[model samples]
Target: MMTISSSTFLMAVVACLLSPAVQALGVLPHTATRTPSSSSSSLFMVGRASADADFAKAPLTQDDQAVDPNVYNVNDLELAAQLWQVSLSSKTNQPNRPANTPFLDTKPFLPKDPTTKYVVDNVVVQVSRTGGLGMQLWELAGGRDDGCGITLIEGVSGNAEAAGVLPGDSLARIQYTTSMQGTQSSTTATEMDVAQAITTLNCECRDFDATMEVLTSLPPPEVVDTLTLTLKRLRTWPQIDVVVE
Candidate 1:
């Protein structure tokens, strides 16, 4: 009879337990090894057996390629990573769409003819201390009394009458030139009060003459040489013929 040492018997038993045929017989493997200093042959056998089982269970493709259960191909992994990065970037960098808005019309409406037409002309007048313009002015009834229009009370002979300004004439605009501090400036007034018009004309005449005095070294008389006024007169009149039988 051959005598087997206890350690050798133990190593053989471990090898049998780690074998797949022994595992099919329902036996659990031991943790111990043979020589107490050798590599774990039982553990290596168990690992190899488990790897073989996994490879057997993995499904094969139509091309007969042995698909790995745990390993990933480097090219496939890189392509998947690139696709994921592209999808994320497209979502993050998308532009906002403009909202639907309605359009608006902004053209202005204009009239063909004006309600009133003005006769523009320049008139020269001499100013007096007692009565400036030497004309009478009246506020018209049913007129634009917001200082935009005025009626002349004429027929009295003075500087205004000499300037051909007639009675019932309507004045709508006035313009004049004035000088102050050696600077000449033009002023225009579309709306003015009777008192304000008198003051403006007087000031303009005084300032202009004073400026001329400084430039020519000779004093000019206090008179407005040119005053622009917009006058409105009736364009049509009613006529009646008289018949004597």
Candidate 2:
């Protein structure tokens, strides 16, 4: 069984956001992979717009252009919803939250160079007579490593997620072409013949000034997409609350 300790994997989820599709999907972990319903799409746009507004002032490079202000079509919104997988884990194991627990606070152990700000809303903290309420949506993944037969955390419903995804559903591959992975590709030049031809780009230079262009199939004309989301702190269990019955 795959156990999800929220604190341990939150960084991995954040790391997954580096993918261009994840940014387009407007969530951290799961990249968007479908067309969204119209209402869901509108809500996604609201959240996406909010995210863009928040990031607008950051010193980012041209690669960040994927998030520029734009209304997403159905596929974009669907992918956004799929990518927002945090809430599913939340529903399975919300702790016995104190009646007076502060909604937000800073963690000393987390990276402090540029403090990550967290905001929690519309979260349903689960209450158990024995276990109390645990923070919801710890993590999500498929049972198989090959990305098939995926299972959601138990006793969770992805539909209740503000991001508009269903729980326990297996995610298919992102409907994208991998045409950019060859030797002739300007980006990620995976050359088989020449060793010196492929030099990894500098980290700082790759961060602020990189703009890669790729040609891929668009979502079907009938599909419309958008993204809707909310967020919360990356949580860890206090020593006093770690025991499970």
Candidate 3:
């Protein structure tokens, strides 16, 4: 729930966000397209979910038609967020850059109850070359570390930019998970039981769905609040080699 009204560190995070590659959402370049015949053979395709489809639906399938290339996938959009690196530093303390905050290292940074979903009200992602990307989370906007998807801001450089990721994008989810280490025990109330219960307590460290949106360039700011963080593997943007039509 930290506000970055005038903090230099806050400004640094904002500096890393992506620039406006497109003046408006509609002005981006024509997305690479594929015809029905070409769709099957095409290496990749970008499209929108059907009205009947759920917002939390899995990545688009072949059935979903190409809505537009200018429109990015959730995965691609989240890459922008990945470019940002968010950490905590007291206002009293100042550094050239904001320190990484291990907010979720212990305790339930996020609630364990399934009903209590994490939702961010307002999220701003900044990308940069000099520093890195910054994810500005606002509590007033309903953002928190325990929410679904990657709570920490991300940055993009080198490989990400070369792959066609643009600035001003926001990631929705990632596609990987690792077992948060827990204690081991045995007996009626053994250490293992305590460790297992604590370890299994589902605190979303990152989200794959949100990351997917960023990668694909289709993140909806309207729905940013309902997203959850998952421990998903990073999706590698499809490598493009010239193709002979």
Candidate 4:
């Protein structure tokens, strides 16, 4: 130490001063033989790797992000309702409605062919006096003094109604019998005889049971015993099948 050079003496003095300063700061000296553990180095590497993985897994586009349905506010729903009401008001105010409007379909539906043919066959209806056949008869008039035939007034409901008789039906034929004073007689009537047939029905055939035999003897003073009618509907305008139920 007595023979040290100037440069060497200065270096030793600096090292002595830095050693106490390092001890005061609690810092490890450079001459200490310490190495970081493998576990600590691996933990630091794993943290960096996890951060990179999370960034890679993020959605690339706005469309790819998941949207929550409940995120819409009340204001958004009110706007939608207002827009619908405006559309409905516009449709209502228009003079000519759009084809898509629902009101046009409410009209009565009729078949495409109005003049289709239909036949009602062998409709036998029993007539009694008490339960008068629920119908109003109108004598058809055109170009002739005597009535052409009797037509049914539409919308009358009765026993004939159940037999599918409609308004404007022509009475074609009728057959009945009358019993008076131990005598029985049968008579068939056509359109020409409708007036006489009606007279007989009102006067002689009043209030008889539907199931009673025409030829059977009734109590005194009753002229006509029983009655049955045949109705016919020709296919023309207002095409519909007159069905008996």
> What TM-score would every model get versus the actual structure?
0.25, 0.16, 0.18, 0.29
Q: Scored by CA lDDT, what does every candidate get?
A: 0.25, 0.23, 0.28, 0.28
- Candidate 1's TM-score reads 0.25
User: What is candidate 2's lDDT per residue for 152-222, written digit by digit as tens?
Assistant: 21121233232233222222112221122234545555643332222121111010011111101223212
* Selected candidate, larger TM-score, 1 vs 4: 4
RMSD of 3: 21.6
Q: What residue runs in model 3 are displaced by over 4 Å at the alpha carbon? A: 1-68, 71-155, 176-245
* Residue-level lDDT for 193 in candidate 1: 28
Ranking by TM-score: 4, 1, 3, 2
Model 2 TM = 0.16
RMSD, candidate 2, Å: 23.6
For model 3, residues 1-245, the per-residue Cα lDDT tens digits are 33222111110012222222222222122122211100001223445766787775556546453222222122332332333333355553434224443222211112433332121212222323222212222111123444443333233343233223333233333222122335555554544532111111232233433332343352333322112222212222222345455
lDDT, candidate 4, 153-238, per-residue tens: 23334444444444433344445564223223345332122223342221111111211121122222244434455543322122
What TM value does model 3 have? 0.18
Residue-wise C-alpha lDDT for candidate 1, range 1-245, written one tens digit per residue = 33221111111111010011211212111112211111111111222234558666554334333222111111121121121110012233323212331111111111443332212122222222222343333332222322222233322234444444434333333334443343233453443322222312111111222212222321122432334443322111112245555
**Candidate 4, superposed: residue stretches over 4 Å from native:** 1-115, 119-122, 162-164, 180-221, 234-245
